[model samples]
Target: MTSPTLALDPAWITRTVAVALDEDLGPAPGRDVTTQSTIPADAVGAADLVARQDGVVAGLVVAPEVVGQVAARLGLAVPSVDQRVADGTRVARGDVLAVLTGPVQVLLVAERTLLNLASRASGVATHTRRWADALEGTGALVLDTRKTTPGLRALEKYAVRCGGGTNKRMGLYDVAMVKDNHVVAAGSVAAAIEAVRTRFPDVTIQVEADTLDQALEAVGAGARFLLLDNMPTPLLAEVVAAVRAVDPRVELEATGNLTLDRAREVASTGVDYLSVGGLTHSSPILDLALDLEPLQPV
Candidate 1:
């Protein structure tokens, strides 16, 4: 059976690729001098997108989209992209992920930009997979935070999903989360929850609590979800029992300073979700390279 692939917003891919291509190619007066002078415009070439290091594959579709956009900009035929592996597939070093064939110059032009998207997304997926694997068999789920690269949130979060992690909330618009600052400004957890509930009656409201008192207070304010911030495993377990006693339905999420080493222990505390910021912000780029095959006469 074939693995399912991710679907991205076509318009977002187009806009992002256009900006990336423009940045690399510069303005019309400036050109890729080396390719322009050496490679003939009609010269056809093929290249393989190879993995320099093992990682989970993500954003395979985006690479082709970027190639097609660059081809249109340069008036070259869009390259044929044959993706050998689906997103979420684990690959080893030297694995050929995809094949690209078209004008050599166009291929060179799109090379770096396409690799940037794929490598970055794959990096996030690879890191997230570790967390998912760590929490395997635990009832808790690995979740991604909003701390993602600007203009790449959707793609990054999608990569997390591909890595077996769940997305907590897309943005501030999707969920109402009252944190410590909001509680301070509102004078209490209940007050903050009340204000958000009064303003956005239909949204899911989650309150952040630093202590057991605040957690109980949040539950009293009709918050069905609570974010237990920075608590140790023992305290987290205690809070879980307390909250469950008050209202068994109140969902709890543990956040702050969550490291992969402690993921299983934290999940054992009975929290429903473990939100990790490092999944996107701190993941190293997966090493990938585009190796051009020798040119042949058409």
Candidate 2:
């Protein structure tokens, strides 16, 4: 399996793993009470991170780091995790994504945290893959919105990319998105575009248009990127034609109420992108489990 095209920052992964471990095990004197009481300190064994349901695999690379951090906090030997498949690979229910070996206590301590991160990431990827598949053969691309979990934006966005979906904007800092509120505050689409242009000349400005008139006004104000919010198929087609007539280079995105069943119909409207907020916010966690092999007598 080939690696994903997008790169995840090593420092970010390490920090995220550290923070997650801290949350689960607590700070400094953190301990897994059950494991500490039941398992012998020197008892060592192996376990497999197995999929309980068929889905795309993700977040395997971060598993080892989680194990190390949890073990370090517990004063135990860090477990080794070997990824069996690359992220984004289509996996079956029984597939092993990674193998871990270390003190039984350490393995048990890291299991839930590892499964939580990987399962959540894989769920987003799986949901996004369906969108990508539905939009196949259409020139339009699938994009994800800012409706991600509060702290898992980076991991969730990375999963989206792995599943062949594009990121619209990382945050408000990267691109200027003049939504309905922004337009209302600025008086009009033209005024909003002008204000954003004056403040951040180099940033790409995307204006939201609810009707043909607003669409045309945005284009008239030199905005080339437009988000066609919640417009029906026929109205979207009209807006597409109207914008194309003004400038063929303008990029149009269709968003709001975009579902998997409506992907083709929306894409057929000639919009350049279809943005889905559910990719991150409402995706269910992919089922995953860790099964430990019995430790042999030393």
Candidate 3:
């Protein structure tokens, strides 16, 4: 069953799965030569996608798409992908997340691609969950940055959501973030804000401020959101208090050099969010493997 919370678009999944299949099986008419050589044309098999380590599951919804795409490329009937666990479900080691039944060749062809997506996504979710768990009850939400896999931003950001973290900005088009470079280019924080507002007035603007003066200047210049980059806990608390006094509605996010051990202390500073780039960049893949049972003669 699909997890209602995971809003993975069907078209995105199809396109991504197709690209992944091409990467593995090569161009059209290209195939898994090993499977073709060893497996009988009509042989069938069953397999389980088992977790080798505990983690929050993700990307199960994309499994069927992967199977179908691989079958299409291999000129075989589409496989039956029975997903046993929904995305976002916490899974223990040895848990069976899905069962696959189809042509032996199709199963083999889709195995690696499916496992790649599931493992990466689950890893991100697991890492984000740790941050989320750390800041629980602190009235602060964990946020993810653009530090995502080049072609898998949607998948990674969705995994962050599954782990109870909020997505900061999907891309540069969606949000106008004035960082140190943007500030330098425009001459001042206010100038950058004015330029972005004049060009893309509807886009949400977030200003990255390294000092308390810059933070206050950003708010006075009408920046409703601020990324408090790399500030110490005491200074961050002071900035938060100062901003709140000036404009209580201005949102604040603490970012950079953050560790799980200091998550609560940072969140306790009354910032609205904490941005972590490591959610997608540094997370290790959640161990998973496809255990294919012996092929059965058709």
Candidate 4:
């Protein structure tokens, strides 16, 4: 197994650990009495951070953040993630992402939380990579949707990028994506585009269309990209051909029920993007573990 590529956000690393500490011991005493009693104060320990499952790594940058926060909370200061592993790299069973050294009490307390972040982040990276790999030669970029963790949008999206995937709108403001409800509420795709365009002239307008005619309506309203929502492959090809025929400059994006097995065929239609909700909603997580070595008296 290759080494882990740690590219986690430093801010998140600190914040995550800080919050964990606050939740567990913001007002409580330091030095978990139970741990202190069981383990001698002079005992030193070492652990080999290893993975139990195969997956790409993301948010590895924050590993040290966890270690540091936990160490500090326990009144021990170990080096913060001394060396980082690369983000967006693959890891196999028994790979060492980083080396953490500190008091045994601190290490034991921080174990579950540390592994949790590493595993989940790497899972997202791995899941996104699979889809990106599936459409490797199709020239279509795999895109992520709004389906994301509540507070980890930045991290999750970072993972997707690490996996060779492109991001759609990071949030509501990054770009305007008008979907089925928006189009209907506005009374028409053209109306939604016109309204948004009238308000934000510089922003790219992407209106979702359920059918070819609706797609045409979106294009006519000066939409730069048309999202073909839930269209079958045959209809997708027809829509792509129609959009190009009407105005070759318009970009077409596909969304809705696109899976790894079917994405290649969809991308072959010359669509510019394909959005997958599963990257966040359904992707499996990577498995990682931390191993400890008995500290010789020093």
Give me the candidate number with maximum lDDT. Answer: 3
Give per-residue CA lDDT, model 2, range 219-285, as digits (tens).
Answer: 9999989999999999999999989999999999999988888999999989989999999999998
Error of 3 at 14 (Å): 1.3
lDDT of each: 0.88, 0.88, 0.90, 0.77
Taking all chains together, each candidate's TM-score versus the true structure is 0.95, 0.96, 0.97, 0.90
Off by over 4 Å in 4: 1-9, 23-34, 80-84
Ranking by lDDT: 3, 2, 1, 4
Candidate 3 lDDT over 1-298, as tens digits, reads 1232659888999889888887887886568888899887688889999999998988888998988887877789888988898888899999999999998888998899999999999999999999999999999988998999998998998898888888888887889999999999999999999999999988899999999999999999999999999999999999999999999999999999999999999999999999999999999999999999975544
Q: Write the per-residue lDDT of candidate 1 for residues 211-269, one digit (tens) a residue.
A: 99989988998989999999999999999999999999999999998998999999998
lDDT tens per residue, model 4, 102-195? 6777777677777776677788889999988889888888888889988777677778888888878868876888887887798877788888
Candidate 3 structure, TM-score to reference: 0.97
Name the TM-score of candidate 2: 0.96
Candidate 4 local lDDT, residue 8 = 48
Superior candidate under TM-score, 1 versus 3: 3
Candidate 3: where is the Cα deviation over 4 Å? 1-6
Where model 1 places Cα greater than 4 Å from the true spot, the runs are: 1-6, 27-30
